[model samples]
Target: MQALLALSRAIDRLNTFVGKYSIWLIFAATFISAANAVVRKVFDTSSNGFLEVQWYLFAWSFLIAAGYTLLNREHVRIDVLNSHLPKKVQIWIEILGVILFLTPVCVLIIWLCIPIVAERYATGEMSPNPGGLIRWPVWVALPAGFALLLLQGWSELIKCVAFLKGLGPDPTVKADAKSAEEELVEALRQHQAAAGKAP
Candidate 1:
């Protein structure tokens, strides 16, 4: 049990690290998009590669951050009747859901994606659009993302079981950590304050 808890913590750490870095993909995509627009407008031309790369970056960010999102408990859920349930009951429901639904879905997706990714890579599949990027890199994200999500599902399952066994704290309680939106807003406020202080 302790070993499983340790594994869960490790998985949590891995996802946290991945989540922290994955956010940069969004910035990269944004920068590429702006640059592509500027080039198209000023130079009267743009490479499909540039445009496609933006999509790639966004896709990578979204897909690879699955485990991180799960770790942070940021995924959408309805609590209309859930909040009224007993804590243990809620945990039990979560355990069942993870075991019955999340695990199978993630595994199936990962299994399905593996062969596709391999085939694309093996064939050196390129985008049909001229000057666009290769397809494999983006294709790889599907399996990679779902694998992370699957690992996270197991991590969450471990945590849920540990809590049920009185070996750990409640797994469903939201930590006091600031959400990504909150952090972004705070940074913007700081930047505004700094600009105001400037000449």
Candidate 2:
């Protein structure tokens, strides 16, 4: 139990850290782009150097939060069909989906992206904006973001395995004997209070 709690806490802390930093990236991207656009239009200047910075920040903002979203269970799911199934059956479907679809997709993306990015690095790839504004280094976002996502995926896979083992955070913890006793006491107290109010 202690080990489980500790592991959960550590993952939660890491998720929080990523979330906080990713917000700054989002705000920085928004702030700089708006400010630069205003200055460019009003003052008649080209947004050359600042453009690259904005691209990098935009990439950071968009991709880095993926893992955080996974951690929070905030990503959308199509549950219209699954809701009719029994809880255990739903879990089985989810487990198979993760193993067959989600995990493989993430793994394949990272697998392909690593070599692609490395080739860019080896050839000293730079932004192709030419005389435009930003030097768009396309590879910055994928590696870091996907690595965190991979980690998050592994943790969720662990959670699913634990559920299969009948050991993850149990839904029936509140249905234990001690909780039933407390509920009975509370019900009696409430009944007595109601009875007192009657007459």
Supply the global lDDT for candidate 2.
0.70
TM-scores of the models, in the order given: 0.88, 0.72
Model 2 Cα lDDT, one tens digit per residue, 16-111: 688778888778878888888998899988645577777788788677778777777667878788878877776677667767887788788888
Per-candidate Cα RMSD to the true structure, in Å, reads: 6.1, 7.3
lDDT by residue (55-119, candidate 1, tens digit) is: 99999999999999988889999989988999999999999999999999998898888999999
**C-alpha local distance difference test of each model:** 0.92, 0.70
With a 3 Å backbone cut-off (N, CA, C), the pairs that clash in candidate 1 are: none
- Candidate 2 is scored at a TM of 0.72
Which parts of model 2 are misplaced by more than 4 Å?
1-9, 131-138, 170-199
For candidate 2, give the lDDT of residue 90. Answer: 69
Q: Which residue runs does candidate 1 get wrong by more than 4 Å?
A: 177-199
Candidate 1 displacement at residue 175 in angstroms: 1.7
